[model samples]
Target: MDILADIATTVLSQLQKPTLAFLLGGMMLAALGSKLEVPTPVYKFVVLLLLLKVGLGAGISIREADLVSLAVPAAAAALTGIAIVLLGSRSLARLRGVSPMDGMATVGLFGAVSASTLAAAMAMLDADGIAYEGFIGALYPFMDIAALVTAILMAKMAQARSRNVIPQNGAATMALGGTGSADNDGPSENRTLVRGILTDTLQSGAISALLLGIAIGVLGRPEAVYASFYEPLFRGLLSILMLVMGMEAWSRLSELRKVAHAYVLYGLSAPLVHGAIGFGLGMIAHQLTGFSAGGIVLLAVMAASSSDISGPPTMRGALPEANPSAYVGASTGLGTPVAILSIPLWIWLADLFIGL
Candidate 1:
């Protein structure tokens, strides 16, 4: 375990940039009108697995020590992240005079944290027995969906302003899968946001593990059920999921270079902004909690500094045709690299101030 952790940490330090390139290459092809073949049977299960992974991941890394001390702080940090990436980014986009579609994409990009980035962090921590692995569960797909819904509302607003099309934010549009908007937040946008998050929560593998945890908590079969049904499956599923996630991220990033130049600002500003929010939330969580270890508490404070994998898919889908792809490329392309440094660095800083 120690050796594996060491390897994972080393990769976090060194191999992440190249890995980003690899992952982005694959995701880009699919996004840019590539018809990638996915087995129909796996799609539904994959969604469930993704959600289940999010929940169990919290269980895996967050000890009873953390749960007792840091749970509320973690929740606060997560909510703050959602607010920043969703609403804050939207305001910034409008100020920049970006189109409705482009603005919505930016909002979603900011709103959603990356799962793949967290996976890298998980590998590093897991390898070392310094198991801060599962906290990345905070960076779920619901973030993307929420932002997508926001983007669509923003698009409707833009249409209304330009062509006077006050498209009702009705149930039919709400039933539509991906509309990006932070304004003109209609009923449909609200409904989809609710549905998406509910889906991510209940339908995901996270819910499955949470159910198992609840069951065990009730039934007193942690060892028996954990080993018998959950452990092996979770480990296997995590490994497979990370590998595929890497591949998909690579594919998505390949097209970023074709977008607008302003995206560079997004790439640069978002991490710094989000990381600061994460640290602040962590500090608040720590001050109020009973977690005794300063180091672990510091790490918890940085909980909102999520995986940066979400940059490409969310942003690429949202940007307007008039915008150069390079900006999106630059932002999405740099996320993994930035996280490699930020997570550990902030953890250290939090310790210096908060630790004994």
Candidate 2:
């Protein structure tokens, strides 16, 4: 009963946050048919700023962090990303109306990190006066890349097996769909596929901005500018981002309905389950490295969030045959909202177990 009461209180507190309030308000406006929208260019620009802010902060923190402290958590994050996709391939992909490739793509998005969501979690923790490792943000790319590579590889292997492509000279030369190369044998084909996925992920707009910011923060002294510009504007810009996301979530609902009921269920539940898995691994990392409760919460947030920006384009290019409505709809329409809302739950759990 005490635990239940704590959860209730945490949720109530979460609902009152301006960040979430803006999100809910946007959803309300969308539901009322207000036809309001943040312009696409503005949204993209806002995302860039947010990513830069997060990356800078993380890079600064990473500069002072001990390599040993970072190792355990980073490894855990990468493992979590791989595990989420593999688990989904077995369970969610096998459900009625969900093809294996489509299922892998959907889970890939879920497994990848959401920059906006990470920013929100950081904001929320700051508001609550929780102290987390600043370097926690550095874990983003590890998890993001791992999930994407694993998903695409698994999806392609499944595709190959399903088609029963015969091996020639002990190696199937059939190129995986998006590689733009057909001359490679089975092993070489896989190497090419992985190399392409890594290149695409690294070169992606979101990741690129983040990596640039991190490099700037690490290699230069931008603390003055960071403190003067990015820090002051973070919350206000985030509110706007949340508002845009809420409206976008509503617009995607119709697309969600076009997919199987299984997708809807997966979207709604995957965040919690995935988050718990992250939280559990975080616990182990905490014990091993004295990782803060707040860092644990952020790690869980990364696991909970579905990729809104990078994962979709990557999936579209890599798994072109997969239906967009299934992966995109399930993620944007349902998974994102649930993940956002689950922040408070994770925070409460982290504090309860680890003493924030």
Candidate 3:
């Protein structure tokens, strides 16, 4: 009963926060047929700023962090990403009316990190006075890259198997070019595919911005500028981003109607399940590294989030045969809103169970 009360209280409190309020407001505006829109350039700029702030803070924290303490949580994050993709592939991907490639693409998006959701989680933690590691943001790439790579690789393997040209082990052989027919170009093709995915992921705007900021923060002393500029603008920028996302999420809802009911179910439920998996793994990491409750909650948030910015373009390039309506519709329409709203639940659970 007390836990239930606490959850209700947490949710109510979070709804009042500017980050969430703006999100809800945006959604309401869109629902009411308001034509209000944040320009594309403006939204993109806001995202870059938010990512830079996160990366800068993380880089500064990492500079002073104990590397050994960071390793366990990082590994946990990577494992969580891989696990979510595999879990979805087995379940959601196999659902009636869902194509395997489209399902993998959808799960891949969910597996990847959301910069906006991560920012919101950070904002919520700060508002609640929850302390977390500075380097926590640094774990983004580890999970994002791992999930995407694993998803694409799994899809390719499935495709190869379907074609009967490559066995399960043959995928590796194709990449490594061992003992296969010399005339077979499978090895070159596989290597190129893997290389292309990695290159595209790294070059994506979101990842590139975060990574650049981290590099700058680590190598150069940006504390004065970071404090003066990025710090002050963080929340305000995030609010705008949230508003944009909320409106965008509303618009995407129509796309969901074209997909299966299973997608709707997966979109609604996956966030909670994936988040729980992250929270559990984070607890294990906490036992090993004493990861903070705030960090655990953030880890859960990362797991819950879908990649609105990076995953789509990468998936389009990699899995062109996959139906965009199914993956994109499910993610932007249902998954993201659910993930954002669930932030408070995760935070409350962390505080109640894991404490500060």
Give the number of the best model, judged by TM-score.
2
For this target, which candidate reaches the highest lDDT against the unseen true structure? 2
Reference-based TM-score of each model: 0.57, 0.97, 0.95
lDDT, each prediction: 0.47, 0.90, 0.89
Residue-by-residue lDDT tens digits, candidate 1, 1-356: 96556545644653354333434444555456666554645644653554444445454444443554545654654565466655554554665545556655554555555554454445444443452324435324334444444554455445444653334542323223334344535565556655654454444343344444433333453555445664456545544444455444455366554554455556555666666665666566666764333324223323333333334433344333324344344434544335434555554454456643
- The residue ranges of model 3 lying beyond 4 angstroms of the native Cα positions read 167-191
lDDT of 3 by residue, 182-282 (tens): 45466666776789789999999999999998888888899999999999999999999999999998999888888889999999999999999999999
* Regions of model 1 farther than 4 Å from truth: 1-54, 57-71, 86-92, 95-98, 128-254, 291-332
TM-score ranking, high to low: 2, 3, 1
Model 2 CA lDDT for position 246: 94
Locate the minimum summed-lDDT window of 10 residues in model 1. Answer: 297-306
Cα deviation at 335, candidate 1, in Å, is: 2.4
Candidate 2 lDDT: 0.90
Q: For residues 132-244, what per-residue lDDT tens digits would candidate 2 score against the true structure?
A: 99888789999999999999999888887777653544344453643334455678777978999999999999899988888888888889999999999999999999999
What are the RMSD figures for all models against the true structure?
8.3, 1.9, 2.5
